[model samples]
Target: MTRLPPVRVARAATTVRTAVQGLTRRMVPPPVGVLELVSGLIEANTVYAVAKLGVADALARGPRAAADVAAELGTNPDATYRLMRAAAGYGLLHQDGDRFDLTALGRPLRSDAPDSMRAVVLMIGDPRYQSVWARLPESVTTGTAQAEAVHGVSMWELLDRDADYAATFNEAMTRLTALDWPTVAAAYDFTPFRRIVDVGGGHGRLLASMLGAAPAAEGVLFEQESLLPAAEELLREAGVLSRCRLVGGSFHDRVPDDGDLYVMRRVVHDLDDEQALALLTTVRRDMPAGATLLLLESIVPPGSGPDFAKTLDLDMLLFAGGRERTEQEYAALLDRAGLGMTRVVPTISTISLVEVRPAA
Candidate 1:
């Protein structure tokens, strides 16, 4: 038997302890699991409250007294103190005396962070989105958008009318896309293609990633006119502006038929089957033989086990009049639109790349 050094023995012991703790956690069931489910709403709303109050943003520099944070944010000191306490309990912040500081998990909440989730937090907590979620029960009962029932308009219509809300929504989408694009860019091979068209590509971030990954490929960004400035700025920042063309158009009427590859990320899930089919048909009409269509969206898995898509399906139901689809459903939808599903490529992110080509 060989004797180990004291430090090495202690490190091995610590590793074993960690492994045992992990296994134990996996083996143990939560006490009153139903209560855990019921209390999730409390945690979610508390997180939202802290996010909206900009508490994390206020503490970006260093730990601050809760009252000072509240004063800076124009919020009530007592309420802010309580909010910070709750956030600290949730491990989003650490409390010391009367000061609160962000923990590792909470640092991403700061707006200055590269991959900040602040936009996501704000967008989800906004009254416009929350109003739709509140009517989710009605959506479940009627198989239609709860927003339509409550606000007498679709989310798109609401966005069109409310510029501020629309900007927030776009920022949220950009933040999410930024997080997911690196995975998609790495998982797919875009080198063979010369031209890539991104339909409904907001800010052109994903397209920029694609273009960056495939140096030889030029890009055509097609989106609403209002998004042009932002997309141009992103493309320029990526140094791919000279290689890309920005085109403002509606996919409902027509799409550019020249590209060898077309990408629509997180777009199809905003419509019902009829509308989705219509948009697909428009693209199919212009899709030359051997061209590819890449849908970058969540593919709902077969069974239920804490899947993000399952939850997003509900959000689609209440707000966008859409639903996440299984692999078979995507195939069938593609077939109907005269496109063939070649393969579904899984990425490091939750979203998958559903690759399709014009039906022979």
Candidate 2:
């Protein structure tokens, strides 16, 4: 039996989903379709509610009546049933009579699940964060982040002040990195590089994975000082602490030099063009002539078809005052920084390894 690559499977699934959406739009009245689009928030909030309420975790043991679950959770039975019914409608739960069970789709909502997404759901659906999205119109009109408008602080500042939120955000990043890093590590050959610097590496998961793959390579995990302890713990857990150096600093200020391979994963999409250029220029200045830089990012594809990057771009705009870029946009940016993009290596996940080097 032959197994298909995850990237190919993902693309096929996307194609099927697009076709289904298009067919539904063509069959439904325009007004009805638009109403469905506008009312998406209802479903989103429903999912958030169930995830927040521990409904998924409660159902993990076995199927149970909503009233029984509600009694355990100290909520109203009827409301719990209604919520569970809505979740069933969304295919996250299954209902038989009055009993509800967690579906495979909802399994990740459990904090103990192998690929848990509970933190991600809570982080995005938190009322404070959702309020920032409410100011999207203002963000679009002013072309700036709405975090300060909503929370009276920049996103980074808010994270610094709110320890719980910061922890959740870090956990979410770790979860995402867990899903993407193995594929990213396999997508490129790291064995040639003796020193690998992961700029803004969060919690050191990605860097740890690369180090495991490239036993010959020592790693530099550069991140804010506050994140160093967590990164150090993760590196130690991965058994790569001896092979890694945990550096505390801001990439905006400086990055470690002379590394043969430098990686910045999901970092550039969080900055505006000017800030991104400055950071890239710093890297270019520090990079040795023969060294390589790999930016692991979701390259926004051309055309009107659906891509998560398109939706993520809007989230970046409203939350961080940044935007996702296309291949051409990245190439131009690299050229301005005295670097040149050599190739884009696709990974099993949506992200790609964009290879670059100091310009000749």
lDDT of 1 by residue, 1-360 (tens): 133234345446656876775666566476645566677878878888877778889999999999999899999899899999999999999999899999988888888887699889889877777778888778888888888777778788888888898888888888898888766765689999999999999989889989988999999999999899999998999899999999998999888889999999999988888899999999999867778999998989785345678999999998888989999999999899988999998765678999989887
Give the whole-model CA lDDT for all candidates, comma-separated: 0.86, 0.90
170-193, model 2: which lDDT tens digit per residue? 988888988887677666888999
Candidate No. with top lDDT: 2
TM, every model: 0.89, 0.96
- Cα RMSD to the true fold for all candidates: 6.8, 1.8
Clashing pairs in 2: none
State the weakest 10-residue window (summed lDDT) of model 2: 1-10
Please give the range of 10 consecutive residues that has the lowest summed lDDT in model 1. 1-10
TM-score of 1: 0.89
